[model samples]
Target: MRKLWLPLLVVVMVWMVAGNGEARLRPDFYGSACSNVEGIVRQAVRRKLNQTVVTIPATLRLFFHDCFVQGCDASVMIASARDDAEKDASDNLSLAGDGFDTVIKAKQAVEAQCPGVVSCADILAIAARDVVVLSGGPNFTVELGRRDGLISRAALVAGRLPGPDFDLDRLVSLFRLNNLTARDMIALSGAHTVGFSHCSRFASRLYSFNSTTAVDPSLNAAYARALMRACPRDVDPTIAVNMDLYTPITFDNVYYKNLLDGEGLFTSDEVLFTDRRSRPTVERFASDQAAFFRAFSAAMVRLGRLGVKTGGQGEIRRDCTALNS
Candidate 1:
């Protein structure tokens, strides 16, 4: 792990230097130009949500995937000709199309009124917040002024996003690269409460965790059986299960409660309680839903500011899926 941090730290230092546009973002950035940008996005999001509940988690996950990459620039939504874009990466291949569709639809509505005044990046930020609110989560203001990124490559995604199996140390180090703290990582993990994960993402916990233990010892025996039933051996890789078995559709601190009961779907998810270091925070969140909401809301605002492109750094992409000609 010492060797891992040394080289990774160098890469992060460079990313920080190149991607620090948070100071340039402001909530009212489009107030003078597209004052109704948030309204337009929220309306589109509500409509989409009515069509399919999947929009809520899909858009939320999309926002995370976008920011964890080169920055929250909507590069993940870019369509590549040769399958080399960020979305084309294996880690991102499972991203539901509804996530991309939400942003594109919102971008279209914004463009109709504001023309080149609004950015796809800003629209995405607003849409992300809209999804959270629509899903019974805390509502928070989203800062705007992000410009669409000019770069989108699969190679840049390696080691950027957190994995399902990362231990506490690995998770902390990876999030720290973006200047986020351990507390922030826990708050973000609350997102799992609302989304779904493919069977392949956590099947290792059931099938072949190690030579000795057939299943992870930390997993509750009943929950492990439930997982195996949903994702039997040789099950279709595309088969997905809700992240939170109790209240999967609602966004809440039940994730922490689930962690406490050893029902967390991923090793990374369950470790919040299994590891003594992060257990207290998990306990606090599980016992106090209000505290979890406050932390999650604040963390999301901070998340939107990561590696944003502002002013001349990026263009107001006329289309969310392609760069301007």
Candidate 2:
């Protein structure tokens, strides 16, 4: 009986150790191949965004327009000229035009290297990072494993995405609806560090605007001047859009930095620095790029999961330029 007991103890210890070993190896076993493909896709998207003549800030705008409207379906990134008339009529300037071409080139290159494995969703994420880097922002790794969303709903564009005028509470709610936390909302809004906005979208804040909403007093002078120059007070209602004056192409803490300095270009953007609840997160991101990157990656992972109808739930349109016929 003593001999049998000793043998059982040894067998149990060996089994436990082996189980631990397999557990440790599981992530690598499951993730290594996908990681490599994701890396390749990231590099490919980066290369294309860098090489393209379109300004980095403009590209970032296109990316946001595409993703926020649909579930990063790459539909907004497609051109409709080859598709039917309904598709052509539905074409969005931000998506179906030059940006779509750029994504297509990148997607084609990635497909050649990795075949059917790499997802369009992953490509969009990589491309966005590339755009930020080109615009003069820090580079961060985006986690892979997002599958391409097949259906792109144009109508979802207006309500789903937050606009420039959204106050802190409204913005927080929008982010929450998408499964994002307050921290995520602040960090993700850091993307504004690189892009531009039309003055028309923000003119209300400068001219006769909401007084209850705090405007950065430090920014009032420069903001008013820039607005005057861009709008001319009485001429055309159209406002020529300009990229974020500083670090328009870079993805850095400069956005938060701008807010701290009262240089934020939009009312919604400046409010992050002033809001009591959100200010600390904004300052943290401003001071620590590493911290910002970590949070941003996490937030992006969450954002990618929002309203995503994956697998058979959606169809992969062969032509991203138009919805499925």
Candidate 3:
């Protein structure tokens, strides 16, 4: 009886923490309070994205990182005085500054039109979609009424965000916890089509991935040579290279095509093609850009709903970087 009780108790705790009891989300959630919310966010995101092209992928990734850990509540944006908040987590350290800046700026813009009428959580969801559209990806509608989470813990990030080297099975297992499927995982990976990765994330593949000889045999020779030059043995860890070299600034199927040619920047990206269960999805996306866009847009909507807050579950934070005071 004791053994059975322990397992059941653990399951219940996990369910509760995952926000299984939160209010449902809807597209017209702010219809009465802020009818112009989406327009406000779209304008703000575009303005900031124009300042730096990197903002497109950064904002998209920011939404993923936030949704995975504790739902799309903007908990990732919370600041910790002790430096032990989600931002302190190593997995989150690579998140570009422009991503956070875009959210902050959007929040400020929304406030100007309808003070205290929008939640950072909803702003993040809408902004993420806008960034994807600006990058030439499909435009999808996001459900709103998400309230901001009050807790932000660094400890939760490690197990939440899939590592840069996660294999197919591992990626599937992690995303499943958030109601994401294998197809969703591959489609969402398409976001890599517009981002940049720091050398440190893939330096191992360029220099002694497994042995001391330097370079992974799975990588294409020409791509490896280029990577070596871009990321030298003693190069600064902060130095970055575009994830999609073929069309570095566009949101397209070239990323999957690169995988077919062995140009994937991270082991995690390459494995999608190597793993049988995921290979078909990768191939389909590579051969058809429209299909990839459709899948990606649908996946984004599903991801945006993970463990979301609605009604009075959370708050409408005045400052996006801090919880309500």
Best by lDDT: 1
Worst 10 residues of 2 by lDDT: 9-18
Clashes of each: 0, 7, 1
- Predicted structure 1, TM vs. truth: 0.94
lDDT of each: 0.85, 0.55, 0.82
lDDT of 1 by residue, 243-302 (tens): 887677688888898888888899999998999999999999999999998998888888
For model 1, what is the C-alpha lDDT against the true structure? 0.85
Candidate 3 residue 34 C-alpha distance from true site, Å: 0.7
The CA-based lDDT of model 2 is what?
Answer: 0.55
TM-score winner among the candidates? 1
lDDT of 3 by residue, 1-325 (tens): 0111111110000000246533377789889988999998899988997788878878888898999888888999998889888877888888888889999999999999899989998898899899888888898878887899888999988788887788999999887888888999999998888878877778888876875567777788778877777777887766777888767668889899989888888999999998888999999999999999999988988888888877768898999999877
If candidate 3 were superposed on the true structure by all CA atoms, what would the RMSD be? 10.8
lDDT of 2 by residue, 177-246 (tens): 6657889889888877654554555666566565664333536465456555665555354334333455
For candidate 2, what is the TM-score? 0.73
lDDT, candidate 2, residue 271? 84
